[model samples]
Target: MIKRIIRNTGLLCLLFLTIAVSQTSAQESSNLKEGKVSYITGENIYVRFASTDQIENGDTLFIRDENGLAPALLVDNKSSISCLCSKLGEHTFKLDDIVFGRTVKPVSEVVQLQQELPEKDVNEQVLITQEPTKESSRTQDINGRLSMSSYSNFSDEADNIHRFRYTLSAKASNLSGSKISAETYVSFTHKLNQWDVVQENLNNALKVYSLALKYDINESATVWAGRKINPRIANVGAIDGLQFEYKFKNMFAGIVGGSRPDYQDYGYNFDLFEYGAYVGQSKKTENGFVQSSLAFFEQRNTGNVDRRFIYMQHTNSAIKNLTLFSSLELDLYKLENDKPTNTVSLTSLYFSARYRFSKRLSVFGSYDNRKNVIYYETFRNYADEILQQASRQGVRARINYRPVNGFIVGASAGTRFRAEDPRPTKTLSGFATWTKVPTLNASLSITANLMQTSYLDGQVYGARLSKDLVSGKLYTMLHYRWVDFQYVNTLTNLQQHIGELDLSWQFSKKLYLSANYEATFQEQQLFNRLYLNLRIKF
Candidate 1:
C-alpha cells in the first residue's frame, strides 16, 4: 500500500511539474489573443477595450479561442463601470478562463467599463462579430458523497450506536450568454440507544441550498448574484459554511446561514442557523496564489447573537519543493441573550501556518487569543472559570517526515486553545494514514490533552486510531479511542475507551453492503449498521 501511494504521488508530482513547466496558454489555448490586461486587482484581470468604435459601454470585448477568433462585448452608454468591476474574479465568476467553475462560457464578454456609447441600450446585446467564437461550452455539474459509521459492542451491551448520512445536487449553465444555476444538499445522523441504562444519545440533521446567475455586463467584468455558498473557512480545511458568496476583484463579500458539527460550540451553529457572509480574493504571482477572506454571521431568526470574523490566508510556493499556507482570523460575537448565564461579549483571534519541506515532510504551528466584551471578565461557559488565567497564549508545532515512499513518520506536541474559555490546554497529537492501492488502508491517530481551565472539570486527554483492510469485494475497518479526565479542584476523574470494527463488500460499482460492531471498555455496548450506495446521474 505504501509503495502504491509513493508511486502515485510521484506520478502526480511529475504531472504538476509538466503543468508548471508549460505555459498555461500553450497548454490550454490553441491560439492566443495578443491583448493587454488592465485593472489588475488581487487575482482578477480585466482587458481594456481599445481602438474600436463598437467597443462602447463595456462592449467590443471578446476572447479568442483555439481557432484564433475572438468574441466581443460592445459597450452601451448606460453601463455602470463600478457595477461591472465588482464581479471580476472568483471560482464561480462570469468567465470560464479558469477551471474552478462547473459551468463554461464562450463569448468572454465581461463588462467593467465603457469608454464609448453604443446605439444598443446597456441591457441590449450587441453583435460585435459576424460569427460566434469557435471556443464555447455549456454545462454545469455538481457532485459529492457522504458517509457515516457507528461502533457497537454486543458483549457487555456497553457500546451501542446508530448513524446515517446523505448528499444530492444538480446544475445547468449556458455558455453563449448569462448563466443560471442551483444546488442543494442534506445530511442526518444519530446514535441508536443509551446502552439500556448506561448512556444517552441524540440525532441531528443538516441541509443546504444555493442558487446563482452570472452575466457579463461587458468585456471587463461580470455581474453575478444569488444564494450561493460562502467560503468562511478557518482551521485549515476543517471548517466552512455552505452559504452565499458575493465575489469581486481581489475581494468578494457575502453572507451564509448555519453551519455545524463544531463539537463544542467552537464553530458556527450548523443547525437551521441564520445567515452569514464571506468575501475572498486570490492573486497570481511568479510562484503561487495568495488568498484572503472576511466573514460575518447572524442568527437564523435574526436578532443578535452574531459571530463575525475576518481571516487572511497567504499561499506561495513559486519556489522549488516547498509550499506555504497560513491563516489569521478574528471572531467577534454580539451576544444578545439576556440570561445571566450568557457571559461577556468576546473576540477570539487565531493564526496558523504550515510549510511543506517536501512531499513527505512539513511542519505547522498555531496560536490564539480571546477576550471578553465590556467588563473584561473572561468569557466563561460556567462559573469557577479561570478569569485572568483564562487569558492564555501558547504555540504548538510539529514536523512530519516520510523517509520511505509508503510509510510516514510524524511527531507533535502543543497546547490546544479553547475559544469560549480562551485557555491553552497541554496537548500532544499525531496521526499517520497509509493507503495501499490493491486492498488496504490504515491510519493511526492520537490526541492527548491536559486542560488548562480553572474548574474541577477542566482536564481531558484522548487519542484515536483506525485501520482498514480491503481485498477484492470485501473490506474490514477497525477504530479505537480512549480518554482520561481529571481536574485539580474536584475529583471529576473518568477514564474511558471505545473500539469498533466493520466489514463491507462491494458486489458491483452500484451496489454495496456493510455491518459494524462497537464496544466500550465498560458500561454500554451495541452493534450497529448497514449501508447502500447508488450512482444515478441521468
Candidate 2:
C-alpha cells in the first residue's frame, strides 16, 4: 500500500510539473482574498481577514494540504473583518494557517431582507459570478500561502509533548489568462521525537487534500481532471478521475466518475469505484435567487454493487425577508441477512430557514434527521447502530437583536429526542457583545449556557475582551470561562475554570505570526497548552 501511494504521488507530481512548465506565462489576475485561522473552539474556527466585503456565510474556504486546493472550511458567521467557520470534513487546521475566499457575489437588495443560502448552493452561486471577461486569457494571476507551526502541551499527570506541522496551498486560475487552471493543498506533520513513525509510513505524517487541473471549453462548458471536489456535486465528496459540466443559460448539468479514497488511511483505493451524475438550475430574481439539484449515484467494491442512493438539494430566497434550504438523501439498495434487497429508505434529511424582519432583528431555525449510511460490501461486520440518538434527530432555533450601534445580543435553544430515549436533551444559550468598552477601548462579550442531558446538567459562563494593540499590526485577546456540572445518574458535581490568551502580529504584507496559550484549573489538577505559528503568503 505504501508503494502504491508513493507511485501515485510521484505520477501526480510529474503531471503537475509538466503542466506548470507548459503554462509559465498563461496566468490571469484574480480577486481572491486571504484569511488566517485565528481561534478554534468546539466545532467552530475563527478567521481574521482584511475585510468581509465579498465573503458571505455558507461560502467555502480553501486550505493547503498534500493534494491541492481542497475545500476545508464553511463560513457560518461573519463580522466586518472576521468570520466563524466550521470544518467541512475530517481535516484539521492550526492557527496562522492561511485560507482563501474569492470575492464573487455583489451585495444584493435581498440580503437586507433574508440570510444567505446553504452550502449546497455555494458552487452554483460562485459559478454565476464567473461571467466571461474581455481581457486577454494569457495574463498571469497566481496566489497561495505557506506556513509552519508548533504545538505544546503540559499536564500535571503526564509527560510534556510537542508537534510540528507545515502546510502549502496554491492556485493558478486562468493561468496566463488562458483556459488552464491548477490548484493544490498539502500538509505534513510529525511529533518531536517520532521520526521513525514517519520514516516507516509517510502517509501517517502527510496528507494530500486536493490536486486538480481545470480547462474551460467555452463560456458554457468546462472539464476537470485529477482529484477534485466538484462544487455542484460536493455532497458526493472528492472525485479522483474526471468531471465534465455544461451550462445552458441558467441551467447546468454534470457527470463524475472516480474511486473513493482508502477508508483507513485516506490513500488511493481504485478498487472502491463510484460514479454519478447531477443536474441543477440557478436563477437570479430581482430580489434574490433560487437553486435546486438532483443526483443519482452508485458505488461498487470489486465490481459488485455496494450501495446506491439519490441526493436532492434546494435553496430559495425569492420571497422578501425569507430564505430556505434543504438537503435529502435516500438509500435505494440494501442488504438484509445476506439477501440482496432494493428498497427506498430515508438516510438523511436537513432543512433550515432564516428571516430578517428588519435591520435590527432576525430569526433562524433548523431540523435534522440523519442515519448511518450503509456500504454493503465494505463493512459487513459493522451492521448495527453505533451513533447516538442526539446526532440522528434534533431541532434548534435562534434570534438576534441589535438594539443599538456596537451593541448586539442573541439567544438560542435546541433539543434532541428519540422514541427509545427516556429523557430529551435540551440546551439554552445567550450572549451579549459590546463592540467598544468606554474606558478600556476594547470589545467585550459575555455568554452563558444551560444544558441538560440524560447523564448530566450543566451551566457555563464566559467573558472575553479583545483589542488591537497597534491598530492593524498587532492584536490581543483575553478570555475566561467557568463550568459547573452535576451528574444526574451519579449525584456528583464538578467544576473547572479555564483561561486563555491570544496574540497576533502582522509584520508585513506577506508575513504574520501568532501565539496562543490556555490553561484549565480543576480542584485536583491543572493543564496547560501553548501554540505558535509563522506564515508567509505570495
Candidate 3:
C-alpha cells in the first residue's frame, strides 16, 4: 500500500511541474510577441517589444519612469495613446497596435471556491503550508491630551485660545472576504485665528468631519463609502473621495469622486464635488507579469452640467535590474445647461525606474509629459492663471540607503514640462532621520524641491518649495506623548514655518490628559495656537 501511495504522489508532482512550466512558457511566448497590444483580463497586455523579452501572467514588474527615463508604465484608458511598452522586473514588452485604453463595466461577483487537499502519504512528500492564527483584524486608537499653553502674535489681541481634537474607529471582517470600518474626526477651537478663515474654521470646529465603510468581496476587491483618497484623478492621493477598489487576479480597477466645478463670479462657484472609477493591473515578479489600473470619475451639480476624468497605468520589470511604469490621464468638463460645458483634454504620461548597485546605494528617476488642450476660455487674471488647473510633464529621481534599523538617508531631484508654455523648472532636495531609541522615539526629515507651477489661470513658471517634518516623544509604561513640527516655502516666494509642542499622559485606564502649543510664521507676521483637554470615565 505504501509503495502504491508513493507512485501516485510522484505522478502528481510530475503533472504539477509540467503544468507550471507550460504556463510559464506560454506567458513568456505571449510577452515575446513583438509590437502587439492586447489586454488580457487577468493580466497586463501581452507585449513582444524588441524580440527578446520573457514575461508571464502575475510576474513582478520593474521598469523606467515616464519621459522614457526612470522606471514606470502606462495603464490608463481614457486618453488616446499608442506605442507603449512595460518592464516586468526581468522582462519587457512592446505594446502593439491594439485596444489598451477603454471603458469596462463591473463584472459579476467572484465565486468563492473551497480549499481542496490532495490525498498523499505524509512520509513521501514535504508540504509547505502557511501557519494559521487568530488575527486582530479590528483596532481602535484614541488620541487625548492635556496641558497649559499661551499664544502671542503680531497683534496685541490677548484672547485666550482653547482647542481639542478627537477620533474613534472600529472594523469587522466580512463574509465576502471584505472588512468594514468607520471613524469620525472632531476638533474644537475658541478665539480662532483671523488670518485664514477656512483654516481657522477647520482648526476650531468640533464636528464629525468624516465617516467611512469598506466592503471587500474577495482577497483582491473592495468598495467603500464616506471618504477615501482619490487615486490619480483630479488631484493625486490627498483628495479624498467616495470610492472603490477592485483587483481581478493581477489586473486592477477603481473609481473615485472627482472635483466639482464652481464659479466665484456671478455666484458661479458652487462647491464642485467629483467622483471617479478606474481599472488596471501590475506585475510584481520576474515571470513577466504586468501592473496596470484604469479609472474614471465625475462631478455633478443638480444635473445641468458636470466634469469627468479618466486615467490608466501599466508597469513591469525589465533587464539590467531596471523597473518601469507609466500612466495617462484625461480631464473633461460638461454642462447640462448647454451642450457640454467647455471641455478640455489634458493628457499626462511619465515613466521611472531604479537600480541597486550595492546594499546601501541605488539610483532612481522619472519624467512627465502634460498637455492641456482648451476648447475655448483663456483669460488674463493672475489668480485665475496661478490657481487654474495645470497640465505639464516632468521628471523625478531619488536615491537612498539604510545602514540600520530606524535610520534612513536619501536625495532626490525633479523637473517639470508645461503644455501651454515651453520652459521647464527643476529642483533638488535631501534629508535624513533616525528613531533607534526605545521607549522614547524621535526623528527629523527635510526636503527641498524646485519646479514650475501654475496659478488659477494657465502658465508655468519657476518656483521652489522646502519642507521639514519632525516628531519627538518620551514615555513610560503608564503614559506617553509627542511634539510635532512643520515648515513650508512656496514658489510665489511665499514662506511659512510652524512649530508645536504637545504632551499627553494617561493617569490610568479610561482616563487621560493632553495639551498643545503652536506657532506660525508667514511673511513678517507671526501667530500661535493653544489648547488643553482631558477625558475621564464616569
Candidate 4:
C-alpha cells in the first residue's frame, strides 16, 4: 500500500513540475499589499487588509522588519478583508505588527489606481509598482520546508521506545505565470523496532495528509481536485474528491464533494463518501470586520447515510479593541434501536472573546462544549455508557497586565463539567515574567498551577530562564518544575522533580537545529526523554 500511494504521489508531483516548467508568460507585474496583525488565538493569526482579493490559501506573508522582509506567516483562511494565518519558523508576532503580501497585477492598473487615489491614502497603505521591461520573467513563487525529528524515551519501569518522523510541506503558487498551483504536506513516522506493525498496515507508517492541485478559473471562481481541506468548513476535515469556490464581492459560496479518509488509519476510503455546500459573507466595518458562514453536510457509508450535520461560524471585530468569534454544529440524523430518525441535536459549540483595555492590559475568555458525535454506520456497536460519558465541556478566562517595561503577570482559571457527570475538573494557573533583567539581560518567568480532578489533586511549580548565546544565531534555556499529587481514593502522595534544557541554533536564513532534553526524578524511578529536529526551508 505504501509503495502504491508513493507511486501515485510521485507521478502527480512529476506532472506538476513538468507543467510548471513548460509554461511561460509575458512580462510579470508585482504589487505589495500591506496589512496589520489584528488578533491572535492559539495557532490562528488574523491580519486585516484593505482586501484579500488577490491572496490565496498557502500564500506566504512576509514580516516587514527593518532588516528587510522575511517569510513569516502562511495564509490558512481568509475573508474579504482579513486572513487567518499560521506562523512560520520561530518568528514571534504581536498585535498591530505590519506585514506585507506580494500580489500579481497589471502595472498599468496599479499606476492608474495610484494616480486616482489621494496621496495620503496611497502612501499609507499601498506602494507603487514599476512596470517591468519586456524581458522581465514571471515569478514562480515557491515556499517549502523539510524536517526530520527523533524522539527517544527511557524509563526504569518499561522498555525504551524510540521513534523517528520525517515531514515535507510545500506550496507553489501561480506556477510559472500559469493559473495552476499545487500544495502538499506529507509525513512518514515509524518506531525503531516496529517492522511487524508496519508490515501489517503500511498506511500506519506513511500518511498523506494533503495533496491537491488548484486552478483559478477566473478572478471570482476557482476549483481544486485531489485531497484538500476547505478552511471555510474546517470541521469537515480533508475531502478526497473535488472542491469549487466562487466569490462575488463581499459574498461567497463553495461546494465540496469527496470521500473522507479511512476512519481507522486515515488512508483513502472510497466506501465513505460525503458532500457539502456552504455560503458566507464578509464585510469590513469602520473599526474591523464581520464574517459569517453556514454549511450543511451529509456523509454516507456504502451509499447509506452515516451522518448529517449543520455547521455555523461567525466572527465580529467591529468594536474597537475587541474581537468575538463563535461556532456551532448540530447533528441532523440519528439511529436509535436499529431505527433511523432525523432529530436535531447540538453536538458542538464554542465561543470566545478578547478585549484589549490598553497597551498594558488585556483579557480573554472562551467557552467550549463538545459531545460524542455519533455515526450510525461507523460506530454502531458503541455502548450507551460510552456515548453518555464522552463529553468535555469547559470555560476559561484569563487576564494579563504589564506593570513595568520589563515585568508582566497573568492568571487564568478554568472548569469542566457535564450534566450527568459526578466529578468536575478545575484548574487555576498564574505566571510572572521579567522579559529583561538589568544585569543578566536574560528573560525569566515563574509559574504555579493547581488542578483538581476526580482521580487526584495536583500542584505544579516551575521556573524558566533563557538567554541568547550569540545574538540571532544561538539561544538556550533552562527550566525546572516540581509536581505534587494526592490520590482522591487511595490517599497516597506522590512527588516528582523535572528538569529540562533546550538549545536552538540558526545556521543560516533557511536552516535551523534544535534539541531538548528532559529528566524526571521520583522516589524510586527516573525517566528521561530526548528530542532533536533539523529543518531547512526554501
Worst ten-residue run, lDDT, model 3? 109-118
lDDT, residue 455, candidate 2? 70
Off by over 4 Å in 2: 1-138, 371-393, 419-422, 491-493
Error of 3 at 435 (Å): 8.2
Report the number of clashing residue pairs per model.
Answer: 46, 30, 129, 0
Candidate 3 Cα outliers beyond 4 Å, as residue runs: 1-164, 174-210, 215-225, 229-248, 252-277, 287-289, 315-325, 332-344, 347-352, 368-394, 401-410, 416-426, 431-538
lDDT of each: 0.35, 0.68, 0.36, 0.66
Better of 2 and 3 by lDDT: 2
lDDT winner between 1 and 4, please give it: 4
Best by lDDT: 2
State the displacement of the C-alpha of residue 310, model 4, in Å, after optimal TM-score superposition. Answer: 0.8
Which regions in candidate 4 have their CA more than 4 angstroms from the true location? Answer: 1-138, 371-392, 491-493
lDDT (Cα, tens digit) per residue for candidate 2, span 1-538: 7847655774568457445644443222266677788654433466777667788765767754332344567665566666666544323455566787867534652243233333222222222223345453454556666788888888978898787888766777776568887777667788888999898866677766667788888877788887777766666766778888888877889988988766766656788899999999888765566778899999989898999999888877777767677778899998899888999999878777767676567677778675433331120111011112222347877777768766767777879887875688787778777766787777677887777777777777889887767766788889898878787888678787878899988898678888988887877888787888887766
Q: Which stretches of candidate 1 lie over 4 Å from their true place?
A: 1-136, 140-166, 169-178, 188-206, 209-227, 232-281, 293-346, 369-394, 416-424, 431-472, 480-483, 487-492, 510-512, 523-538
lDDT of 1 by residue, 1-538 (tens): 6635633543353344333322211122322222222221211233321112222222233433211222332211111110011111111122112111101224422311221111111111211112223354434332222333332223434343333344333332343233433232333333364333222211223332322334434332334343333223432222233334333555655444443333432222334245544566555434333444555544432344444445444443344323344444554444446432333333444444545454445555545443332221111212113312332345556666556544444555555455564444554444443322223233333333334443433332333332323333554546564545456656565455656565555454323455645444533433333333332221
**RMSDs, each prediction?**
19.6, 6.4, 21.4, 10.6
Q: How does candidate 3 fare on TM-score?
A: 0.43
lDDT of 1: 0.35
**lDDT, candidate 3, at 422:** 45
CA shift of 497, model 2, Å: 1.1
